[model samples]
Target: MTDRIATFPDWQTKPTVSPVQGDLVYPGWLAGSWSMSSTLVEMVAPLAPEVTTPGFEGNRQFLNQPVVCQVRFLPANVVERNKAILPLLSLPTQSLVNAQIVSDRAFNGLNLAKAYLGDRVFRVWIDPRDSNRLITKFRDNRKLFSTATGRTVEQPDVDHFITTELFQQFFQSPEKPYKNQVETTTAYTHQPDNTVTADQFTAVYLQPPHPKAFLAGDRPVALYHYQLKFVQQGVR
Candidate 1:
């Protein structure tokens, strides 16, 4: 898991460490009430077709704004014998999952552990420079139960963004059978209710140059594109 305190070296203020922080990220360029509709294009790995529901398709559906990007609520190794880890001690073993929203363009994120899993928790950090960027990091220390004797492997960076005007992706394998690309652009408009509809969000995906039996002749896969929308409610 990524350390929340270390992630924001330039934060305007110290975050009040808690189970949730959705309200803090709203009303800014990064915050808003958002939703999307995704459509699948190709099937490379032969996985089951994602079930489409109302207003969206695929498991890569909507990205509700201000969702928790990361969390840690329980100790995976230590038993809550006598409730040593807080309120959880009164009941059973305490384990927590921290979920947070790393970006509004896509479902980019990072998760950390406080007292569970291995001695080191896992984390996914997005590169701030690229809209479709991500980085994998790990945390090992006395908190998670690591005695400094083990080395945790870093996670591989991934781009969940798919080429579509709606800024969504296909629920495909993480090890993309073929390299994929994506880009996103954003804008905003004022609604009559005083809330601003932050629209003009667009994304595009193209298969990176690669040798494939399917592309034998002069045929090529077309690039994919999508557009997304969100509403930013002004703080009263």
Candidate 2:
């Protein structure tokens, strides 16, 4: 049996170009402080043997419970210069850059018990190799280790933009209870109310033989669908 880890799309070898010099533009719309409400709408365990099995029933607890969070996007300089290593290597230091900071009373809704999950900071940059793609690196935090790659679909004529991000998350310590990968797709539409409504869907995957797996082999463990709405409050 092969013991190799799963391979994801490579971001390191992707060409890097100065943001302004390429079609790959930083997502300017994401800049600003906003209040976000995220609701888990659906959950499914694809590989489970019985559709109505008790193992999957626990997912219902998250349905329709909206968790609120404070999300802020700041200029890259807001982050310490020492933390800017990844983005600085490919993009011009003087160019416009963005970093996202997220905090939630419900631990960003990941914890239903409303535990305190420390603030998460993320740096965003255009993929030098693909203009249609963007890469984000989550800074070191006490909670988790994650990296995400996203692809954008823009319809400038209709003012609609959608970005789908694939995220890989690993427990900081091997003893941590669970570890999984998630994909979230968010759609943005400009509303007449001067607010952008975002709808998101997230799917969770776990390798078989994983500590938290319901089945005994490698495959998807669960899928979670979420709806999120963002209302801009002010500039960060």
Candidate 3:
């Protein structure tokens, strides 16, 4: 997993990750609310001429702009104790006993999607029994169903956590249903100043139903990188 983040935009094939089962655990430090700013710094189309991605050119408008949103990770009693990690002691007001730190996916995902997709986003929900499945619904009656097929996690230190999840996505569209693979890798650092910073990389791969799927194969056709800064609420 370290090798994947070290390589950056040199990505070609998908990272080899284990099958996703339970919610991804976050470090104890990340167990709180945060105001996040995500800025798109770079984007690339590896096979532009032959297989340009759908949103390659349209995304250029957001190149240097930061999308601000609210997100939170919390401690929850995950279903499987085998996947549990020792979370820090809970706050006086918050009881996190026998809980594993996990992202509030529905709350965080909804707010984040609205930050980019605006009010057009109707809802974002995850399967109650399955942490790997997610759905984002739009007001236009379109929905994006995503399932985390594989993932990998690493923690070099208590202050640093890295995770990469590979998702199989199906989009309900007016013309046709679109299927693709999306990979997101984020390296988060907890700073001494009580803030958090991260480097996030995303890749989009064409899948079977796509006409040029054969040409793209397992390689990603579109790549994007974002710089993320998070500040806890009420903190300077």
In candidate 3, clashing pairs total 0
TM-score of each predicted structure versus truth: 0.28, 0.54, 0.89
Q: What is the model-wide C-alpha lDDT for candidate 1?
A: 0.25
**How far off is residue 1 in model 2, in Å?**
34
Q: Could you tell me the lDDT of residue 5 within candidate 2?
A: 9
**Candidate 2 per-residue lDDT over residues 1-236, each given as its tens digit:** 00110121111111111222212222555445567777877676665653222335765766898777655444444432322322223434233333432121112233322322223534344344543333333355324444453333444445466544555555554344345655555566667765667666555655433655554233444555667777876433
Query: Which residue pairs does candidate 3 place in steric collision?
Result: none
Give the residue spans of candidate 3 off by over 4 A. Answer: 78-98, 234-236
Model 2, C-alpha of 141: deviation from truth (Å)? 11
Give the worst 10-residue stretch by lDDT in candidate 1.
Answer: 143-152
**lDDT measured at residue 51 in model 1 versus the true structure, 0 to 100:** 18
lDDT of 3 at 193: 91
Whole-model Cα lDDT of every candidate shown, in order: 0.25, 0.45, 0.82
Sorted on TM-score, highest at the top, how do the candidates line up?
3, 2, 1
**Model 3 lDDT-worst window of ten:** 79-88
Q: Write the per-residue lDDT of candidate 3 for residues 1-236, one digit (tens) a residue.
A: 77887887888898888998777888877766689999999999988888977878999998999999987666665323223222323343253433577887777788888998799999888776666788899999999988999989999998999999999999999978888999999999999997999999999999887899999888889999999999886311
lDDT of 1 by residue, 143-224 (tens): 1111111111112222111111112233222343333322222233434553333222222232324434223222212221
lDDT of 2 at 215: 44
In candidate 2, where is summed lDDT lowest over 10 consecutive residues? 1-10
- Residue 13 deviation, candidate 2, in Å? 24
